[model samples]
Every structure is written in C-alpha cells, then in structure tokens.
Target: DCSLAAEQLKNSPRHKAYLEGVSLRQLQKLYSLLKGHLGGESLAESLENDKELAKRKSIMDELFEKNRKKKDDPDFIYDIEVEFPQDEQLESCGWDAESGEEI
Candidate 1:
C-alpha cells in the first residue's frame, strides 16, 4: 500500500514537483516517524503506548510550521544567525571549570 501510494505520487506532476522540494533529511525523518507509528501496532494503540513520541511529534510539527521557508521566497536567507539575550548570571558547570592541566 505504501509503495503503491508512493508510485502514484511519483506519477503525478503536482506531487513530483512537491517531492522535489523535499530534502532527503526530511524524508528520512518522515520515514522514521512512520516506522514508529506503524511498528506492529494500531495507530491509537501506538499513540497510547508512547505519549512522549506524540508530544515530540507535535513539538516538531509546531517548530516546522514556525520556521518553514519557501525556496523562492525573497526574504529567505541561507544562513541565519539569532542571538538570545541573557537576563540572568551565567552558571558554571563541572565540565566547564578550570581543568588546571595544560594539554
């Protein structure tokens, strides 16, 4: 069924263009999600068994929507840099402490 659906999409011109815009990393991530959802269990049963996965999927969906950009968009930038303002003092972690030994 999945292969048939894929073949149908491949044959469709509209879907073929859409698929061309999708990256391999995105496809791999989608395949991973589908594998988790269909791993020998019903959809509802799988969702009930792994609430964390459902939560993660929702978060990822939200992030994807928030950060989505079109290839032809005039405002799209290849490398974006964002800096978050720090309002609190920086805390030192054990790993970041002075090791005292020179390499």
Candidate 2:
C-alpha cells in the first residue's frame, strides 16, 4: 500500500505543501525506492534464492537512503546539478545515429 500511503500524504493538509515543493524527478525516485521496498515481482520467492536481485535492491536502497532529503529540510535544494566524470570512451548507439535517408 505504498501508493496508497503516497496518495494519503499527497492529500494531507500538513504534508501537501511539502509534496508540492518536491520535484517530479524526486517523486519518481521515491516511487522507485518504494517499489524496490515492496520486493517487486519476486515477493513470492525467497530473497536468498535471488541473490543478484537482492544485491541490486540492496545497493539501490543504500543509495536512496544515503542521498534522500526531506522537502522541509533546511539543506534541501529545489534543484541540484551533478556532473559524473566519464573515464571511458563513449559508445555510440544505433538509435542515436541518424539514418542517411531524409524523411
């Protein structure tokens, strides 16, 4: 019922402003974290049997927990710009290359 909780929070008078101040990308990330928390489609299977998925989920959870900020937090910035350093050469994708034929 994560979605339900989110809906309730969104509609709550006390939290409505805080949610409104949050960006769509932040909300999406929250949704992703919540979905991961729910164990996704592998809920029926034991996490021990799906070590890879569990590991990925663990990493995601750690990252989200480490980086998450509340809308009301004094240090919370509405916008943030982060540049990731690329040490390796970029690979070109087929979809990114233009077809020679004109439309």
| Leading candidate by TM-score | 2
Residue lDDT tens for model 1, 13-72: 877777877655555545544765767755666456458777889999999988889778
Question: lDDT (0-100) at residue 58 of candidate 1?
Answer: 96
Tens digit per residue, CA lDDT, model 2, 1-103: 4455566667789988879877555555466565665765344343334577779999999999888998988999987999987997899999899999754
TM-score for predicted model 2 compared with the true structure: 0.29
lDDT of 2 at 16: 87
C-alpha TM-score for every candidate? 0.28, 0.29
Query: Candidate 2, overall lDDT?
Result: 0.70
Clashes of 2: 0
Q: Each candidate's root-mean-square deviation in Å?
A: 14.1, 14.0
As for candidate 1, its clashing pairs are none
